[model samples]
Target: MSVPLFDAATPRAPLREGLRSAIDRVLESERFVLGPEVASFERELAAYCGASQAVGVANGTDAITITLRAMGAGPGDEVIVPSFTFYASVEAIVHTGATPVFCDIDADTYCITPETVRAALTPRTKAVIAVHLFGNVAPVGEIQALGVPVLEDAAQAMGSRSAAGRPGSLGVAATFSFYPSKNLACFGDGGAIVTNDDAIAEEARILRFHGSRDKIDYEQVGYNSRLDELQAAILRVQLPHLDQWSDGRMQAARNYEEAGLAELASLPKPVAGASPAWHLYVVSHPDVKRLEGALAAAQVGYKPYYRTPVHRQAPMLEWGAGVDLPATEHAARTHLAIPMSPGLTRAQADEVVAAARAAS
Candidate 1:
């Protein structure tokens, strides 16, 4: 039997009953875009994340760009971000006409700490984007204490919490992606911006829809990035089950721990007060190439979580030309994402563990 990284179909089967009904209801209403479904979903999402408000957007990248624009971050400003994270985090900062100051990540957490952000800070620094990488939350509280407004790139950390609080509630504003692979996902592309600041929330709402509260009135320049009714409806059906799914992923992590995979490779370390969403169970080894080859032979699905850090990417060369990031470079070469999802069965889990042991 071939074990895949994630089987969206198996987990989504149970949601089909409610999801189909919701889709039908939306079709009958004929309110396809920025309609009742999107409004309700926003409210539910905000409440779930312990935020005062949430604004739905077209995708995660839009969520970040819209938040930065809403916060008045633009040209002549710098936004600090981790070089080890996904390119979208830095890409959004660049889109806002702000310079992205790449910072090194903590070797253990694979997350940017307050020290890193502080090192990268300058008078031109306007904000910081703290990414909750691989389901583990960043030390957002300490970073926020630095007096810079932090925007959480929580695309991979929907159900996660740390010592401070939930991802969305930790920062000044938080962004989420409902990409199909995320913990809380829609069928297609979707995203949201959550915040307690009324002004920020209001601005995000307008910015997502061409900077207009009313359809005919244009208040400011904004992008066309509204979450459609169809995707919103589907997200509502899956929202209720998010915690349960996260729990399953945590159990799978425990299974990996019990299998003593740490002896063979480096496993994720537990944060003292964190309850990670377990978006992906990553393991690192010095000999990652050999392990990958063995897994491929056993028909086990595996892939490098991030083989290239953002700083080393061709387009980012101009920004990071002189930067030296030993930890980020090391992580990029060693980390590999094994099969992980709520839908993975015990038999599949055991198969992965056995294959990993054999490979080691």
Candidate 2:
């Protein structure tokens, strides 16, 4: 009767003792900023994602900004991104002194496609950020085939995979978020940049700590952003459980489909050979308002997000000029996310299913 969109407490219950132990370890170490825990988490994260290296940063936005700057994106350099994604994607491009060229999403997957990237291409296109929105892995392999560097905002897709590989290794560089609500969550805000390219990873490492490998020299202008030791330790505890969590979410998504929500709405569809972690379980219904009403009446949590596409937002409006995004517009008008979490129970899921059916 009272299902929340994110059940943070439930997911961490089993790991409570481990989390406490991690915090105790960090407290005992007394090396709070960028210490051994961060190093170990970075190494373990890279290994998990099948990448050569991973650099921890303060948060997901900074991870993207640092990776873009490391990849040589600067003023006048344009990065292609889908407007249907979260605003932080574009904001990161802006922070790196690069222009964000907003594009459309594939109506089904709600992700940018190789075709969309092709449509947004120009001589100044420095890179393309393929966002794996709602845990559906973007078509990174196909996008890379276009020969432009691809940066993945894999914030919602830490455990998701495609035929080529995992999210972190699919693009030229990728970013992951460990916000408490994320699948691979931490105690607080944290993020990482992962890549097979050692050079980019090295740059990211420097960028994460004020442009200096050692404390002595200030090599380049960089923000003071580092994932502190406590958060890193907490993330380490959760990282080992991420694969199992992702599997649970995938199964929950299947349950929704089997319960007949698919008959009433357009469910998220993964690309060929991709396995989405079902981060948000967003759906698009023709009468989305009705669905919203049903969920509300049933005391079930539902969210209508990105109703205003990033291009329409005040700060990024100029980039919207003369840009066409009918698909993005359609998605913005119709889509909403139902309750989904690794800890979501079948009874809670059934409550959601009943509400969705009520809408129909």
Candidate 3:
């Protein structure tokens, strides 16, 4: 009974029938590029996020890169990003020729804090990327008030809610990923950018398709980033089940929370007004090495969300003088992501909770 950190195969299995049918339809139709399926899914996803428009792209990294480029961020400008997120976040900023100002994350939520953003701000800072880390929305509203355009990195938070009780509508643009491990995953890589701004939306749409406004008329020097028709069809099939899947993940998290492992392991608490999508069930402990070993012995799985913060990585974008991020550094060292997916059975969750309690 070896539990991997994530088993995307289980959740994708239920959609096999629909996926097969959709694939066959795509093959028969022969309209494999950005067509009806892609457009329809974009519309549906926009509505789901309470945004006026959504534009699909090749993958999550492309989604961020194109969105930033479409928003007019380039070479000399600076974009503030979370130091605790995946490499792709900063990579996207660098791909645009824009510099990324890395800011530390909150101790609890592991998302960039407004204070950190304020400290990192400069005259060249044009935008802030608020990453909804681990399915919990960050304090985007506060970051917005800083007089800079905000980009919501909702990659792990497709169905997440903000502290204001808003559902994925806090920035000039919001991006979502449909990687295999995401709660609302596609069979392969897929991503979208959601926004209420019509101009931004239109720009992103055009930019995604080689900068073509009409047919072969290149408006700007954009790359090929269109979302494939097949991926869109898969997303259309999975969209309806996202909230239901998120609910199940939340229930599993509640089981761990109620287990009172906080007494021994440092458990994460949900923000005051957030309805997190519970993408990953993370817990921190100073003795993470010992605890993770115990879980491995019990046949449960765990892994650190980030072993090293972004600023410490080799790809050093021209960020300003680095400041000590003690909390972020500690979290990078101590945090562990437990087995958490909608497909995780109650028995499995109980087993994980029991293992955690014993390790504690």
Candidate 4:
């Protein structure tokens, strides 16, 4: 049996008709950019995430840059971020002219903890990006207690939650990606910045456009990165079903244990009290080569993530020349995310586990 990672098309099968109707509605309106579709998505997304407001943007990376600028981060400021996450997290900080301070992550959770954040803080530290990596929510409330504003990097955690609350509500502000792979994905590129702070929300809205609330005047320089109507309309159609899908993913993750994968490899340990969306069902083994060979021979779909930590990337060499990220390096070497999605079936999951058994 062949198991494939991330069956994006399968999940959309159930929503095909609704998606078509949504597209038709957008076509009838004939308003593409920053129209009613985008406006409604912003409002609905904010409410779903337990936030005061949300501003739609072109993509997840733009969402980060706009939110950072709204929080007053710029040159001469430092923003602490975990090196274990996606490159977009660091790129946005650099785009804002803020120096990116690399932070290490906890080995178990693969997320920056309050201890790690404290170690990276300086007098010039203006903000911290708490990445809710792989659908596991970061400890934003604890990190926020450190004084600097904490931004929730929720690109992979749209349906995730912690005891404190949802991702967008936990941090000063949060950013989400609606890429086809995400939990709350649109058909194509789309993103949003959500916050409880009305001041930040107002600034983000202006920044997403051409730096002006009204088209007549320009305030500060900004980007032309607004989310389009078609994508937003499709996302709106999917929003109501997200919770059920996320629950399904979480249940699928548990099936790995039923297949006895834990006996063969180390499964991810989510943070205490976290109800993760399980965007990727990652596992680690001491011998990576063996695991790789077994999965390939069995035709089990899998992908190694962050083999090179963002801080160690060529463009970031100068920034990370002397940084010591022990835990981040370990995760980079060991982690491999396997097939995971609401559409995943028991037979596919069994194939992956059988491969792991052979590897062990």
Candidate 5:
């Protein structure tokens, strides 16, 4: 039997009854964009994350850019970002016209540490983006002590929490993506910015709709990045199930641990006080290529979250010149994401572990 990397269908099938009705309701109302459903979902999401406000947007990338812009990040400013994260994190920084200063990630957590952020800081540093990579929270409390605004990129960490707080409530502002594959997924692209600061929330709302506070007036130049009503409704349907899905993913991670896969590779290490969402079950080995080949032969799906560190990407090389990120480079070369999702069966996880052992 072929085991795919993610079985979105299995988990989604259970929600089909409610999803069909939700879609029908939207179609009957004929309200497709920025409608009541979007507002309702935003409220529900904010309440879930323990935030005071939430504003829905087009995608996760836009959430970061809009939040940065609202926080006064622009040209002549610098934003510290993790070199090991998805390229979209850096891209959002660039969109705000602020330089992205690359920082190395912690070898154990695979997320940036406060020490790395401090080393990357410059007088021009205006803000920091703390990415909750692979569903594990970054050290928000330590980074916040640096006295600059911190934006939590919780795109992969919907149900995660740290001792500091839930992902959305930890930073000055946080971003979430419901990109069909996240812990709390929608039917299509959707995102939101959650914050406790009233000023930031108000600005994000204006900025997401072409800088318009009202239909006839434009406050500042902004982009069209509103989350559509359909996606919002779909997200609402899935919101209540997020914790259950997260628990299932956590169980899968435990299954991997119990399978003794650690003999072949290193497993993910959650932060001491963190309750991770376990978005991906990633393992690392010096010989990742061999492990991948074995999984392929066994018809078990596997892939690397990031094979190339953002700093090593061609477009980012110039920005990363003279910067050294040993930990990021090592993680990029070694980490491999095996089949991991609430839908993954224990038998399937065992199959993946068996393949890894054979390769080792």
Candidate 6:
């Protein structure tokens, strides 16, 4: 059988019963739009994250955009973002009519460092997006001390925690995605913005629902970005087991590390002082293409999280300062993810490590 790169975990059969019941209740009540399910999920999520409030959105991108808009980050403002991240991070800044300043990441953790962010800051810089890439949390406390609004892109980092707090807990707002591949994925697309600021939460809620605090009154121009009730129901069921699944993935990572395959090639390490959720087990070799081919021949699946960093991506090339970013450039060429998921067993991890060792 072909070894797939990942197989996302789902709620246990018993846990899914509640999800089904919740869906059935929503169906019976015919409250498909921002209803009791969404509200309750938001509250639960907020409490779990140690936030005062949470607002459900259509997806993570909208969560970032709405939060940015509410923060008054607009044209002429620059948002510092790590170049080595998913496009959505930069896309949200651009969507807000703000300029995204690309910054390099740390060699070890593959996360944007506070020093890099400091260097990228300018007179127009208003916000910084700390992306918790590959389930590793960024050093947000130091970044927050820069006196700029911080946006936590926690799409791949659900259930990840730091001593200070969760990924977004230190930021002005944290955005999360329920994409199928994420650690806390839903049945379909969904997202949420978590924050302690009541005003920011209220504004995101309004902006997500067409800028209306009241049903009939339009407060400000906005977009439709509400998370569906069904999706919230799915998330609620999944959230309870999120920590368990994350630990399973972490166990898989430890198994891979103990297998001693990392000695064969340079591997990405989790960020210091942060507990990663192990969204993907990424590593790098000098000749990534050759390694990838070997894995293919061995039927061991792999993927490149960001084959092209956002600043280098064709669509967002304008974000670059034409500076030489050795780290980001090197990462784009060598980064490769091995099979890693809550569903991945030790045997599966061993097989992947064996293939990688042979390739190395």
| Stretches > 4 Å off in candidate 1 | none
Q: Report how far residue 58 has shifted in candidate 2, in Å.
A: 0.2
Backbone clash count, each prediction separately? 0, 0, 0, 0, 0, 0
TM-score of model 6 vs. true structure: 0.96
Q: Please provide, for model 5 over 4-68, each residue's C-alpha lDDT reduced to its tens digit, 9 standing for 90 to 100.
A: 88876887788999999999999999999999999999899999999999999999999999999
- Per-residue lDDT tens digits for candidate 6, residues 1-360, read 356888763335557678788778778988887888899999999988988899999999999999999988999998898889888888998998999888889977889888889889999998899999899999888888988888899998999888888865778889999988888888889999999999999899899978998769999889899999888888888888888888887887887877786876676687778889888888888889888988898899888878777776777867674756789988888999988877677677678777877776
Model 4 clash pairs? none
Residues forming the 10-long window of minimal summed lDDT in candidate 6: 7-16
Assess every candidate by TM-score.
0.97, 0.98, 0.95, 0.98, 0.98, 0.96
Clashing pairs in 5: none
Each model's C-alpha lDDT? 0.88, 0.90, 0.83, 0.90, 0.90, 0.85
TM-score preference between candidates 5 and 6, better one: 5
Range of the 10 consecutive residues with the lowest summed lDDT in candidate 3: 314-323
Q: lDDT of model 6 at residue 220?
A: 80
Against the true structure, candidate 4 has what lDDT? 0.90
Candidate 3 CA-lDDT value: 0.83
For residues 231-268, write the lDDT of model 3, one tens digit per residue: 99888988998887888778777766666556767776
Model 6 alpha-carbon miss at residue 175, Å: 0.3
Cα lDDT of candidate 2 equals 0.90
| Error in Å for residue 223 of model 4 | 0.4
What is the lDDT, from 0 to 100, of the residue 68 in candidate 4? 98
Cα deviation of 167 in candidate 1 (Å)? 1.2
Question: Candidate 5 vs candidate 6: which has greater lDDT?
Answer: 5
Least lDDT summed over 10 consecutive residues: which range in candidate 5? 1-10
